[model samples]
Target: MLAARASDDGALADAATGQSEGGVRWAAFRQGLVTNVLNPKSIVFLVALLPQFLTDRSTWADKSVLGAVTVLMVFVWFCAVSLAVGAFQRVFRRPGARRALNIATGLVLIALALVIVLTG
Candidate 1:
């Protein structure tokens, strides 16, 4: 969302179609949180994976605390990633900068594809 706002191309979906930048970020957070909570894949993974660490004495409270901690860690990591990406966007949001980046990215992708095809 921040990247799109930072770009001249207007590529990102308006997760928050509002008057303020904070609103957009809040919307993005809510969307991500709700999506993660509702996603069956995540639930299945958590159910399947979290139990490996459990012992016979582990209770629901223990699971809840672990889940909360896991969620907090994920949120912190997300914040860091968003901040880094947002800072980069702020630096390279100009039309000319975006064009240069696009060209570079395209060239890199083409080179990678060529390398894969040639080597494989």
Candidate 2:
């Protein structure tokens, strides 16, 4: 049976059960979690944007609820994106599709880097 592997990393999904070899790829999950948590935009949002909705009248409970909701929404968004990508695994496996995706992602990353350099 053909199984799915996310990358050169040992993250594998069984063909029959559609589960990872062991379970959740904790390493990858941790890496992504840390990356997202430390992202400048996320930091800015948390420091600046999140406080915009708060007032002197707001309490710790309100702040906690808002933070929890933000976390939940981000989790849901990432889960949806992961599922969508998994659904198109076969398409992504195609050489043409893979190459196109790689090129597009590379270009975007390069552009982002250039922007950061110029802005900084």
Best by TM-score: 2
Give the alpha carbon lDDT tens digit for every residue of 41-96 in model 1.
Answer: 98898889888888899999998898898789878988898889888876565666
Name the lDDT of candidate 1: 0.76
**Candidate 2 lowest-lDDT run of ten:** 1-10
lDDT over C-alpha atoms for residue 79 of model 1: 88
Model 1 lDDT-worst window of ten: 1-10
| Per-candidate alpha-carbon RMSD to the true structure | 5.6, 6.8
RMSD of 2: 6.8
Mind sharing the TM-score for model 2? 0.66
Query: What TM-score goes with each of the models?
Result: 0.61, 0.66
